[model samples]
Target chain A: MLSEFDLIKRYFTRERAGRASTVLGVGDDCALLAPTPGMQLAVSTDMLVEDRHFFAGADPRKLGHKCLAVNLSDLAAMGARPLAFTLALALPQADADWLAGFSEGLFALADEYGCELIGGDTTRGPLNICITVFGEIEPGHALRRDAARDGDDIWISGTLGDARLALAGYRNEAWLDAASHEQAGARMHTPTPRVALGRLLAEQKLARAALDISDGLIGDLSHILAASRVGATLDVDALPAGLALQREDQALRRRFTLAGGDDYELCFTAAPAQRAAIEDAGRASATPVTRVGRIEAAPGLRLVDAHGVPLALSLRGWDHFQQ
Target chain B: MLSEFDLIKRYFTRERAGRASTVLGVGDDCALLAPTPGMQLAVSTDMLVEDRHFFAGADPRKLGHKCLAVNLSDLAAMGARPLAFTLALALPQADADWLAGFSEGLFALADEYGCELIGGDTTRGPLNICITVFGEIEPGHALRRDAARDGDDIWISGTLGDARLALAGYRNEAWLDAASHEQAGARMHTPTPRVALGRLLAEQKLARAALDISDGLIGDLSHILAASRVGATLDVDALPAGLALQREDQALRRRFTLAGGDDYELCFTAAPAQRAAIEDAGRASATPVTRVGRIEAAPGLRLVDAHGVPLALSLRGWDHFQQ
Candidate 1:
C-alpha cells in the first residue's frame, strides 16, 4: 500500500500556473492567498458522504467534479468570482486508478474556472469529500438572502429537477429509457456552476437576493423569503423544468420542478424594472433565465396555476436527516 | 429525527460578537470575510474520521477540540493570526447531547482565539469532521518549510511523545499508571495550538522556517530539510519528553519522542545568533522553547547523543495507509 505522503504527492500535488494571488500552495503547513484589495472573500463548504450523497460505486471522475462543482455553485449563488478551494478527502484505500481519474476530473473543472486547489488532507476511512471554496466579491454587492424586496420578480437560471429525476431512476422509483437516463444522469453528475450569470446579475445590479436551488426550488426559495421577511406568489406552471423532466406527466413534473433536490440552479429575485437588463444578462452569459414568480410583502408562500387559480400542493425539500 | 437545517441552526449558528472582519457569518449562500489591507490569508485544512483518528465512542467534546486544534496547529506553523473557519461534518444521527458537547468544546476554543465559525455543512453519515481554517499574515513573512537555512538552530515548542505514549497504553503495547495515563491522554485529546509563539516568531523575525510536528519529529523534520535543501544534526537525547513519559525508560522515551505522532508542537529553525531573541519570544508567549538540533549543509539526517556521538536507530513516522 502507498503511504499517505506518497499518495498525496502522486495524486493531489500539482504545479500551478503562477496565479498571482496564491503566494504559497501545496507542500506547506498552510497555503497563503493574497486577496485583492477592496474585495471581500466569499467562502462556502460542503461535505459529500458515500451512500448518503452518492451510490457506493459512483464514478470517481464524476464524483470529483460534483464535489467541487457543488461548492462553486454556492459561490455562484453569491455572485462571487471563483478564486481557490481546498479539498479534504477520506478513502478506504489508495487505489491508483481511482485517484488518477478523480484528480483528472477535479483539475479539469478547476482549470476551466481558474480556481486553484491550494491545500487538503487525505486519510484512510470510509469515503468522504469535503470542499471549501473561496471567492472574491465587492462589499455590499453580494446577492444576499435578506436583500429581496416586495414586488420583485423571482427568476431562475437554467433548468431544474433533472438531477432529482435521475435520482428517482436510480432508486427504481421511476422508469427511464436509455437516452433519458443518460441525459438526466449527466445533469446529476455535471451540473454547471452559473458563475457568469450570477456575476453579471450582481455587477449590473439586476438581482437583489439569490441562492442556488440545491434542495428543490420551493424549499430553497422559502429560505430567501424567510430571511427577507417577505412572501412569494409562485406561478407553478411557469417553472422551467429540465429537458427530460419536461416530457414527464404534469403531476411528476410539478413535483420534481417544485420540490426536487440537487438542481444546482440559481433562484433569484430582482426588481421588475430590471427585467430588460436581466434578460440581457441571460443572453450575455449564454444562460436561460425564467420568471417563475413574484415576491410579495405578505409573509407566506402562495402557489398558483397558469390560469391564476390557487393550487394546493404538499411538497417539501430533501432533508438528509428527515424521517 | 432533526432535519439537517434544524441541527445546524440549533447547535452551530450563534450570535456573532460583531467581528469587523466577518461581513456575513452564517445564514447565507456563503460567508463573507474582509481581510485586513496588506494582509495575506493563510488557509489550511484537516479531516478527522472516527475510529481512524479517534477511538469509537470517544468523548464528543474532546474529539471536537482535537479536530479544530489540529487545523489550528497548521495555522500556528505558518505564523498566522486566526480569522475564521468553516466546518463540514457528517454524523450517524442527530443526538442533541452529543451536538451540545461538541459545539461547546468547539466554540470554547474558537472564542479564545477570536476565530468565528463562519459557515459549515451538516449531514447524516459516519462521523467525520473536516475543518478549514483561514488566518491573516503579512505577505513574505509566512514561516514556510522551504525557508530553513544551513547553520540554523532547530527549536521545538512544548513537549512531545505523550500522545503516542497514550496510544501505546490504549493499544496495550505499554503499561502506564492511571495518573500517567490521564496526563498523557489529555495531551492527546486537547493539545494546545501554539498560535502565540508562532505569531511572535514571524512578527519578530525570530524563525527562518517552521512546521507543526504531527507525524513525529524525525519524519516531519525531514520535510523541512528536503524543502530547504539542507540536512540536520539532531541531539536525540536532548528532546524534551512529556512529564509522564519522563519517568519511563530512556529507550522507551527516546523511541516515543523521536517518532511519536500527534504531538501538535512546533518544530522551527532559526539562526543561532538570535538565541537571545528566541528566548525572549518564548517567554513572551509563555511557551517553552528547546534547542535540540542544528541545520547542516550536508544532505542527510544525523542523530547524536548529548556528547555528540552519532547514534544509529531505525524508525519511521506514522503513515495512515502504510502496510
Candidate 2:
C-alpha cells in the first residue's frame, strides 16, 4: 500500500488551482492566505461520513463532488465568492483508484468556481471527508439570515426534492423507473452550487436574506424566520419540483418538496420591487429562480396552497441524530 | 440522545471566546471573520479518527484538548497567532457526559488562546474529530520550512520522546512506574503548543525555517532539508529526552528521541548570531530551547555523537498508513 504521504502527493498535491489569495498551498505546516483588502472572509465547514451520509459503495467521484458542493453551497448562501478550501480526509486504506477519481471529481468543480485547494490532511480510518471553505465578500453586503424583512419574496434557485427522491429510491421507500432513478441520482450526486447566482445577487445588491436549502424548504426557511424574528407564508403549490418528482403523486410530491433534505438550492429573500433585478441576476448567472413564499410580520410559518388557503403539515427538517 | 443540533448548541456552541475578528459565529451558515488588514491568514487542518489516531475509549476531555492542540501546533510552527477554528465532528451516539467533558476541554484551551469557535458541523457516525484552525501572521515573517539556510543552528523546544514512551508502555514494550506513566501519558494527551515561542521568534526575526515535530524529529527535520536544499549534522547525543525517558537505556532513549512521533515541540533553525535572541524568546515564552544540530552545505543528514564521532542509526519517521 502507498504511504499516507505518497498517497496525498500522488492524488491531491499534484492537482491544484493556483489562486493569488493562496500565499502558500499544501506541503507546509500551514497554508497562508491573503484575502483581498476591504473584504471579509466567509468560512464554512461540512463533514460527510459513510453510511450515515452516503451508502457504503457510493461512487468516489460523486462523493468528492458532493462534499465540496455542500461547503460551497454554504458560501453561496452567504453571497461570498469562493477563494480556497482545505480538505481533511479519513480513509480505510490508500486505494489508488479511489483517490484518483475522488480528486478528479473534487478538482473539477473547484476549478469551475476557481476555488483552490490550499491545504489538507490525510489519514487511515473509516471513510470521512471534511472540508472547510474560505470565501471573500464585501463588508455589509452578505445576504445574512437575520436581514430578512417583512414583505420580502422568498426565492429558490433550481428545483428541489430530487436528491431526496433519489434517496427514497435507494431506501425502497418509493419506486423509481430507470430514467427517473438516473435523473434523480444525478441530482443527488452532483447538485450544482449556485455560486455565480449568489455572487451576482450580492454584487448587484438584489437580495436580502439567503441560505441554501439542505434540510427541506420549510425546515430551512424556519431558520431565516427565527433569525430575523419574523415569519413566512409559503406557497406550497408554487414550489419548483424536480421533473422526476412531478411525475409522482401530489401527496408524495408535497412531502418530498416540503420536507425532503439534501437540496443545494439557495432560498433567498428579496423585496417585491427587486423582482426584475433578481430575475435579471438569475438570467445573468444562467440559473433558474422561483418565487415560492413571502416574508411576514407574524411570528409563525403558515403554509398555503395556490388559492392562499391554509394547508396543515407537520413535517420537521432533518436532524441527523434524531433520524 | 440529543439531536445533532441540540448536541452542538448544548456543548460546542455555548463556550466560545468572543474574538474581535469574528463577525458571525456558530448558528450562521458561514462564520464571518474580519482578519487584520495587514496580516495574512495561516490555515491548517487535522482529522483524528477512532482507534487510528487515538484509542477507541480514550478520555473525552483529553481527546478534545489533543484534537485542537495538534492543529494549534501547526499554527505555532508557522509563527502565527490563533484567531479562530471550526470543528467538524462525527459521533457514534450522543452521549451527554462525553460531549460535556469534550467541550469543556476544547473550550479551556481555546479560551486560553482566545481562539473562538466560529462554526462547526455535528453528525452521527463512527467517532471522528476534524478541526481547521485559522491564525494570523504578518507577511514575509512566517517560519516556512523552505527558509532554512546553510550554517544555521537547529533548535528544539522543550523535550521529546515522552509521548512515544507512553505509547510503548501502552503496548507493553517498555516498563514504567505509575508516576512515570502518569507524566508521560499527560505529555502524550495534553501537549502544550509552543505558540508563544514561535510568535516571539517570528516577530523578533530570530528564526528562519521551522515546523512542529509530530512525525518524529528526524523525519520532520528532513522536510526542511529537502525544502531548503540544505543538509544538517545532528548531534544525536545532544537531543533532549523527556524526563521519564531519561532513565531508559542509551539505545532506547536515542531511538525514541530521534524518531518518536507525537512530540509537539518546535524544530526550528536560526543563525549562530541569533542564538542569544532565540534563547531570550524561549525564556519569554517559558519554553526550553536546546541546540542539537547545525545546518550543512551538503545534501544529506549526518548524525554524530557528542565527541563528533559518526553514529550509524537506522530510524524512519512514523508514517500513519505504514504503521
Candidate 3:
C-alpha cells in the first residue's frame, strides 16, 4: 500500500487550487484561507466513534454524511451560511470501497449546501471521525440562545420521536407506511441541516432564540431555556411524533418522543406577535413549523399533557458520557 | 459516575464562559464567535490517536498540551493571533484524574496565549483528540507558503534534529548531563506554539512565506517549494542540528536533520532586502532566527553538502497514513 503522504497526494490533493480565499491548501502545516470582507466565520466540531456513535457495520456513506451534517447543524443554529469544512478521519486501514462511498455521500451533501471540502487529515487508527465545519455570517448578526424572553412561543421544525423509534429498531432499511419514515431514516443517516430556515429566520429577524435538536426535544430545548433564563411548558399533544411513534405503546411512545435524540430538527422561539409571520414563512418555504410550547416566567423545564396534567419519566435522553 | 451530560456540565461548562471574541459560548447547539473587527479568522485542525501519535501510557498533561499546541502552531504559521479553540476528545471511558491533568496542561498554555476554550464534543471510544484552533489576522495579510519568490532568503527558528533523535532512543533519563535529551523530550511532549513571534512578523510585514515545521524541515520545506513553484538549496554546514545530533555519526546526524517531525518551529522565507530587519526583530523578541538557505529558480528541493553535493535519504519524515 502507498504510504499516507502518497495516498493524500493521489486522492485528496487531486483538486486544483482555486481562488484567493484559499491562500494555501493541502500539503502544508495548515491550510490558510482568507475570510471574505465583512464576514465572521462560524466554527463547530463533532466527533463520531465506531460502536459508540454508530454500529461497526454501518455504511460509510451514511457515516460521512452524518458527520458533516451534524457540524452543519451547529452552523445552522448560529444562523451561519455553510462555506467550508475540514475532516479528520482516523481509520484502522485504507479501504478503497469504504472511502469511495464515504466521499460520495459527504460531497453530495456538501455540494447541496455549497460547502467546500477545503482540507482534512487522514490517519491510521481505530475508526474515529472528527469534522470541523466553518460557515460565514455577517458580523454581529448570528442567532443566539440567550436572547429569548418570557412569553415567547417555542416552535419546532418537522416531527419528533421518529428518529428515536428508528434508532430503537429500524436500521434505516426498515420502513413503516408513512411519508415521513423515509425522511426519518434519511435523518438518521444523513440529516438535512436547517440551513435555509436558519437564514430565513435570520433575515426576517423572527427567531429570538434557536438551537438544533440533536439531543431529545426536551433535553435540547432545555438548553435554550437555561441560556435564556426562562422556563418552558411543552404541550405534549402539540408534538408531531412522526409515524413510528404512533405505532409504539404509550410508555414507549412517550419515552421516544421525550428522550430520543438524532432528530436534527430546529427548535426555536419567537415572540407571540411574530408567530403568524414565522408560520407563514415556514409554509412558504415548504418546511413544517409546529408550535409545541411557550417560554414561561419560571426557570425550569416542565411538561404538560393535553389536559394540562404533568407526566413522569424515568430518564431524560441520550447522554454522551453515559454508557 | 455522572452520566456524560452531567460530566460535561460539571467539568467542561463549569468554567466561566471564556471571552476572547465569543459572541455566544457553550449552552447552544454551537458556540458563536465574531472575529475581531478588521480581522479575519485563521482556522486549523489536528488529530492525535492512541499508539499512532503517542504511546498509550504517555502523560495526559503532556498529551493534551501537545494536541492543542500543534493546532496553535498552524495559526502561528499564518501569522494569526490565537483567540479560541474547540476540542473533540474520544475516550474509551472517563478517568477523572486524566481529565483533570489534561485540562490543567491545556488551560495553562491557553491562559498564557489568551486563547479561550470555547466549545467541543466528547464521546466514548479509544483515546483520540481532535483540536481546532481559531485566530484573527488582518484581512488578506495572513502569511502563506505560496508567496515565496525565487530569491527569498530561507529562515528557521530554533534547532532541529533533537526531536527525531529523542524518538530514536538517544536519551538518558537520570543523567544531569543529558539536559538536551530532556529538552528534546519536553519538545516532543509539550511544544510551545510560536504565536507571539508570528504576530510580530505579521505586524512588521516581514515574512514572504511561512509555515510551522511539523513534518521535518526537509519535508515541510519541500512543501514551501512545491506551493511557491520554486526550489531551495540548504547549506548542511550552516543547518542548526541541535545538541542531540552533535555526538552522532555523520550519516545518523544527516538522518536526524532530514526527517525529524516534532520540532514545531517556524520555517519561513523573506526577501533578501528584509533580512536585516528580520534579524533585528528576532533579536528584539529574543527569538533565534537563523538563515538556513535561499529559494532557487529551479522547481525541485535539493540538500547540499558544504561542497554543494546532493545527499540521499531513505525516507523523508513521518507521514500520517504511512506505517
> What TM-score does chain B of candidate 3 reach?
0.93
Q: What is candidate 1's lDDT per residue for A1-323, written digit by digit as tens?
A: 78899999998888776898898888899999988999999999999999888889888899889998999999999999999999899999999999998998898999989999999999999999999999999888899999999999999999988999999999898998888899899999988999999999987778999999999998899999999999999999999989889888999999999999898999999999999999999999999999999999999889999988999999998888994
Instruction: Write down the DockQ of candidate 1.
Output: 0.92
Instruction: Please report, as a residue range, the 10-residue window in candidate 3 chain B with the lowest summed lDDT.
Output: B168-177
What is the overall TM-score of model 3 with all chains considered together?
A: 0.92
lDDT for each residue of candidate 3 in B136-158, tens digit (9 for 90 to 100):
88866778888899999999887
Give per-residue lDDT, candidate 2, residue A8: 83
Every model's DockQ, to 2 decimals? 0.92, 0.90, 0.62
- Per-residue alpha-carbon lDDT of candidate 2 for residues A39-120, written as tens digits (9 for 90 to 100): 9999999999999878898898998899999999999999999999999999998889899889999999998988999999
The lDDT per prediction is 0.93, 0.93, 0.78
The whole-model C-alpha lDDT of candidate 2 against the native structure comes to: 0.93
RMSD of each: 0.8, 1.1, 3.0
Residue-wise C-alpha lDDT for candidate 3, range A8-56, written one tens digit per residue? 6655563643755565566655565566766767788899999877779
| TM-score ranking, high to low | 1, 2, 3
